[model samples]
Target: MPPGVPAPPRPPTLPATPVAADTRDTVAAIYRAHARELWRVLGRLGVPPAAVEDALHDLFIVVQRKLPGFEHRAALRTWLYAIAVRIARRYRERLRRDAHDPEQDVVSPARPPDRALLDAEAVRVLDELLSRLPEAKREVFVLHEVEELSAPQIATILGINLNTVYSRLREARKAFVREHSRHRFLGGDAP
Candidate 1:
């Protein structure tokens, strides 16, 4: 190193560009690779199935448009999950504004042999239970329990403090257990 020479800027460790090549192929590949998982994630977040198609479509459009800007600081999957959450949140808002639509909505992007949607009874139970949770607690619970992300991973994905993630998980667990216990003891009579 020469005495007068300045050090060069370190190259970014993360990938500097997004995965998708063009908008069309990006949309198609995203659907092929991740649409089903995204739907499941949305379902657990309380996004009705009917709205999921439109919401997911919209999400992909946004992703396509934004892909070039993605710096890949996080794993691509985690980045996609964050996008899904935002899209689902917007869909829920629309539902609130237009209550005239059906109360329960389900999406069947990929049909399993047994069923196209969540078991009706299970969805009903989950929806009912999730309705009682605080928004923060519900999001963490859905991401961790339903989406199957670990706590530390979720904290990184959501860019939240690790302690906040743990706190939310505790609250969610407490609420879920209390609700489940009441249901079992009262034989489904509890609210």
Candidate 2:
């Protein structure tokens, strides 16, 4: 038995592979740390708040199971975002199918009374305006403005051109501002 050679460095465990179960704990830790922000991003991308928790859980489950195969060609957050957006899309599709059922309607998140008084009227006005926007414009608007994503990142996430993202953002801003101004003029400021 040789005792002076540091045990030959313990002979690496798993086979050399592109993906390994070895990364699971690290991935899970990163996911836990980043989860709230991820959900916020998905919500700003037009996922109803009601669907956000389930969507995030499902997304992470997929990540846990599939991430061993991840190629690392993109940033981990970007890859997670791609998954989140797909999950949000599926959530929206299901919501649409359930649209005609009264009991199936998605609920808006609850707001505290004091906070609602402070901001509800403005939020209500904005939500109404946003709801009226063309779907593409609303998506870009929320992603860029509410989610605070850069135009290039939005383009990448949505698989759209940068110019398209810019144009949609411009249109969304214009429409929202116009509607807000009108509402203000009409004194629709009650909370």
Candidate 3:
């Protein structure tokens, strides 16, 4: 080679291979980050309080199985939300089939008596209002109002268009307000 000639540009070096994430550590991290939120979401989605733990376990089992194939096409929270929704639906259906009454399983946490009573009544009224909504509207309302996800995010999680999410949320809000007013007017306990 001529002394003055520049060496041919080296081929671009390939990046080092990424280490595979440890499944246990990955699952633990995911649980640590999202468990509390998922628990609340499951309960609001109508999983009986007694079964919420089991449903959460089932949701993680699915995550474990599917984690390897996850392509990061959606945000992790959105993916988890989708899984919780399905698991919650299954638990709700099982409860119905078994003729289980969710209210009977309610166990008020230890608190000042007045606070506990008020909390319980508020939860009861909220649940009753949510239950009156159609499932589609309820899901939209919960994801938007409770989870505080934007309509676009809810649409992605629920596999619906953004407009549909907006429509359902609007309807759900109207129903919730109407029912709440009626409950108050009828002398239901106001917390």
Candidate 4:
């Protein structure tokens, strides 16, 4: 009926609270609010605990520089996760290049002995199981289970099909169970 008339502008679907015209302030606010999430995602991506903070710092550095171009086509968390995955890969490569061994480093001396032991065992078991999962599965599991992101959010973050995200999560759970059982059989820490 109105083919000859001009079309109206489509409203933006992305939420605008965290994203605004001032790039630096928007990015700084995001860092304040979501840096811990970035750290957790980086940890799941295989960034060593000692290096996770550094990786996070590095990630924000990228975000700070690129914030101006961020189109908000995706949720802020999804954008951060995508950046984290890339930074984790780079950090892992850098760790390999440097021949660093996180295990050989000294554990913190401040914690009580029993709690430290428990934490160490927990980390050992989790690392063992998560490392054995495929990279895709691990990311999906961590994003869905640990981070509590919805399937659609995880799909957006990973840029994968929605169905593929669900499959990976299912497979990751199975793989984790298998690995945990194996660890238990070996008397590592699993119950």
For each candidate, how many residue pairs have backbone atoms clashing (under 3 Å)?
3, 0, 0, 0
Task: Kindly indicate the candidate among 3 and 4 with the higher TM-score.
Answer: 3
Candidate 1, position 5, lDDT: 19
Instruction: Estimate, for each residue in 29-135, the C-alpha lDDT of model 2 and write its tens digit.
Output: 76788887787766555556555667787888777556555564557776677777778777767767777522235344665222432255655455556666776
lDDT of 3 by residue, 1-191 (tens): 33322222223332232323464456777899999899878877887666677888899887766665555454889999999988988987888898966546556574422243236766657777778788888888888889999888899888999899998898899998988888789997656
| TM-score head-to-head 1 vs 3, winner | 3
Q: Please report the candidate that would top lDDT against the real structure.
A: 3
Q: Candidate 1 at residue 3, lDDT?
A: 35
Candidate 1 lDDT at 8 equals 24
Question: On residues 72-142, what C-alpha lDDT tens digit does candidate 1 reach at each position?
Answer: 35376787888887887877777778874443343346553224564567765776688678767888998
When 1 and 2 are scored with TM-score, the better candidate is 1
**Model 2 Cα shift for residue 67 (angstroms):** 1.3
Q: Top TM-score: which candidate number?
A: 3
lDDT of each: 0.70, 0.66, 0.76, 0.73
How far in Å is the alpha carbon of 37 misplaced in model 2? 1.5
Q: List where candidate 4 sits over 4 angstroms from the true fold.
A: 1-21, 71-74, 96-124
Range of the 10 consecutive residues with the lowest summed lDDT in candidate 2: 1-10
> For model 3, how big is the CA root-mean-square deviation?
11.0
TM-score of 1: 0.73
TM-score of each: 0.73, 0.67, 0.78, 0.74
Clashing residue pairs in candidate 1 (N, C-alpha, C atoms within 3 angstroms):
49-105, 49-106, 49-107
C-alpha lDDT of residue 124 in model 4:
52
